[model samples]
Target: MLPDEPRSSADPSPEGGPPGCFRHPGTATGISCTRCERPICPECMVPAAVGFQCPECVSRGHAGSRRATTRFGGGLAGDGGLVTRVLVGVNVVVWLLAAYVLTPQLGQTWSLFSAGRDVLGGPAGIADGPDQWYRLLTATFLHVEWWHIGLNMVVLLWLGPPLEEALGRLRFLALYLVAALGGSTFAFLVAGNLMNSVGASGAIFGLIGATIVLQLHNRGPLAPVMAFLVFNLVVTFSRPGVDWRAHLGGLVLGTLTAAGLMYAPREHRGPVQALVVAGALAVEAALLLIGMSLYGA
Candidate 1:
């Protein structure tokens, strides 16, 4: 090349015609990075407030690029809460235990069986049976079928992040656990003595219900949430071997729980949330007693 002509696009232009890209010698670049003043091709350009930047300058802008957090310190993606993650982890761990260890060695005691529902009258049985009372809580975490757990987890993952961020960790966890209990209790109330069930559907449904209530309270769109609930309920009733009773129980309980949270006096929200949790436990107890009475009768 002559002295007046640029050797390559990567080299600086002669007589200010256009500078060659630093990285690609053959590509001519007219613009220089505001920070580095280096000639860069279109591919390397990173948009900035003042002007475009080269890759090196853009890479060091981590501090500037971070968006402000919410009141709860959540990130731009609403990812500060860990309660949802912990709930998922617990469910997965318990599922693994049930599938690999408990089911084989301990049998179906971990699952919710109608046998657990006890009565003081003619239904002379164990409210004290081997792990019977505990099954309501434990069954929520136990899923023998691969697809059962997979579908439940996918739904939880999709719904958990935003709800957890909105409600904070403790309240979110309370709602989920309570919903699980409610579902299992409902199942116990209706199922035959020989019937058994296990899965996280109750908890997943609870999250769905909670999300709908929360969005409604915030004056956000409601149609989508209602549609989701309606679709899932329809599927629950139509699908063979699916526990619609548990899903309905969970949805109702979750909706109540979220409503309690949203309506409480702002200064006393924590106490109200705790009270709602207590009420859920009370409802579970009441349902179990009713179920026991029916079984005994």
Candidate 2:
């Protein structure tokens, strides 16, 4: 009989001897797997709804069962917020390094300086050369002022956990990075080459955009999130030193990323979400290249 087919009758014992467990051949036993009908020792038995099953049968059953996932196809493991805490910690450590450990000139190296700008009497910033491309990502984590990092981290702590739980750690991290790069790319393209910018505000704005998208996806109340977004946008435009381009770019990219993630077809969610992120990154890279050419960097 097939392994999973119901047995008509229990198998006879080995010639002149009791049956031994299929797994532990040395152990004699009268019990059999309810599903497979193979002789089983107590150690190899697993409790089932009707009767004990052998380990192999239980494993097969579990293998066929669907795994639990978040509403947006994310694994439930991200609910713990490990990624969020790590991001916050990294931002804080970078800020501390810039604020105290590094000299003023050295710290300026981490900021996203304007294209073709002469810093410390030398060419610096991303658009200055292809080798300095790291600044696009590094600038997001660099901060010299206490209030700048403090406000960003606070918003991150507030928005990160739920979004992480919804999108999963890997997706959430990807969105943050793509948003940060998008912000940097926009700032580079729009702001004068002489204008320098640094802060996690771009990535934080991405989180806000994600939260708003998630709220809409779940049909939840929007007032609270909308109010928060509005206030921040006001600050972005009104504040003299703020890089509104970065904020706007991050927000727009983040929103599109979150929408693609949350609205993807169930059968193709992973691939679709991946395509969305990759597309965003590609667009930003193209824009950066165009900006470089325009600035003669």
Candidate 3:
């Protein structure tokens, strides 16, 4: 047999092992660090009033100990908040679902667009029922392919955190809803039929537009902001599958809405914000109604 290993007082038994210590080499000593679950040495251990903790646990606890107790506002500056996470999740899920179900490239006759179009009206714009108006809201969530959703989600990931933190969740979500409806309204107007266009770009672009106002309101640098806006605008026109009109409409609506929300007077801010958002939406709706009036002519 091999020579027995040397033992010290730190080692509990003659075998030089504690009860919970690892059987193999390079294993935990006795208890794991409560925070990171790492095996810590006695020298590295930090004594608590009740038990011992590792250095990492001591450091983490010490760091958090002096921090303010408030919960809502912290951590958003580092990365993003819950709203940003939710938007990212929603876009990703919808995109993946569309890819599996639709199979757009193979001409498989399966598409969320076509399904939404059929639901809203026949391919020829023939309305089947009065309740079809709701598709305008529902269709905004659908998209055709990976690039489509990817582009929008990338922008959302980039733009959402600052905006969500700046405006709070309710306002950020409201702006998104308005911008999305604003885009669909424009598509309905331009196509004059039940043509379905889907993607989060409109709302993503809205977030971008709102960021512009936010930067302006805060008197921050503008060159980087302008560069981002211009690049995306170019992409909107340069790509074939992209919806430039809806993008443009959403940008304009979002800019106006954000301007109203941020720059408008404090006392009248609510009413002004409402009017600007509602008016932008109404303008697009009127255009669609006017076109529909002429559709049968």
Candidate 4:
């Protein structure tokens, strides 16, 4: 038989006030831990299967039991979509700084380019120099136009949360960064060296590709997602001033990254996921090197 668990009693304070939290005696609280029955204030309470548990009880329970994971090996904690919200906030902040504070022309410095040129009476772009390689990632977050950022953020908010929940936060972030790099590399290789490209469309397209792969892995319905992807592809090719190369590169790399995560062997999932992201980066680097050499920069 299981031993009886010790229960804490909610005793009144010496001052004759209502019972206070065990952790913070100065704060009165009516709620008690579900398991140990210790008094817990709102901040100290953690939602449990039944009622709230104190921080200590929750930690103990977690230590004693295996933590739950998503089907793709991601921890269930990512269900809150905190990373997605933060990404949106960061994008908005960067946009505000670039558009208003620094001036849009100056913001173009963050754009991806294999070669630099004068635009609007100002020198812009990285000039295919190795030192400013950060532009590959930064360009993903830089957007000057309202509609451009608005559309990308909406897509990111729609797709990022579910992907984060399925793949876990770190893996999801890896996928995003790698896809963004892939898109930038592709743009650098294919777009005119003097042409500058900026926006999160590539990363957003990467999310779309990852979502499609995930849906396929889970045996979920494919028609809706496929239709969405097709429509976007059409828009990509049909629209002028849109960099199709970035979208294509992001989609290809993101799909490959998700496939690696979803199909990895259960026994070696973590290492394989890491390898997949690393492989994608390696390929991007190799492509960039070859492109640079061919461009004679």
TM-score to native of every candidate shown: 0.67, 0.86, 0.62, 0.76
Q: Residue pairs in steric clash, candidate 1?
A: 9-20, 9-21, 9-25, 9-26, 10-21, 10-25
Q: In model 1, where do residues sit more than 4 Å from their true spots?
A: 1-79, 116-131
Off by over 4 Å in 2: 1-18, 47-51, 78-80, 117-123
**lDDT by candidate, in order shown:** 0.75, 0.83, 0.63, 0.83
Candidate 2 has an lDDT of 0.83
Q: Candidate 4 overall Cα lDDT vs. reference? A: 0.83
lDDT of 3 at 176: 82
> Candidate 3 at residue 186, lDDT?
68
lDDT of 1 by residue, 188-254 (tens): 7776344567788888888899988878778899898789889999999998988888898888888
lDDT of 3 by residue, 1-297 (tens): 246856433345546565333223344377655666555666666777766677766777788775431122222243336677887887676666667854554222212132223233443321222244455555556666677777777778788877777665656677787787677656655654434466767777777888889888889988887899999889888988677766876787787877777775655755775676678777767755654454422
- Expressed as tens digits, the lDDT of each residue in 145-175 for candidate 2 is 8988999999999999999998888888898
Off by over 4 Å in 4: 1-64, 116-127
lDDT of 3: 0.63
Model 2 poorest 10 in a row by lDDT: 7-16
Of candidate 1, the 10-residue stretch with the lowest lDDT total is 117-126
TM-score order of candidates, top first = 2, 4, 1, 3
For candidate 4, write residues 1-297 as lDDT tens digits: 234854333678557667879998778998889899888999998998899999888788779997688877777892558889989998999899898998866476777755533234222244445777788889899998999999999999999999998888888888998888889888877753566778998989999999999888889998988999999999999999999999999999988988998899999987898899899999999777766655534
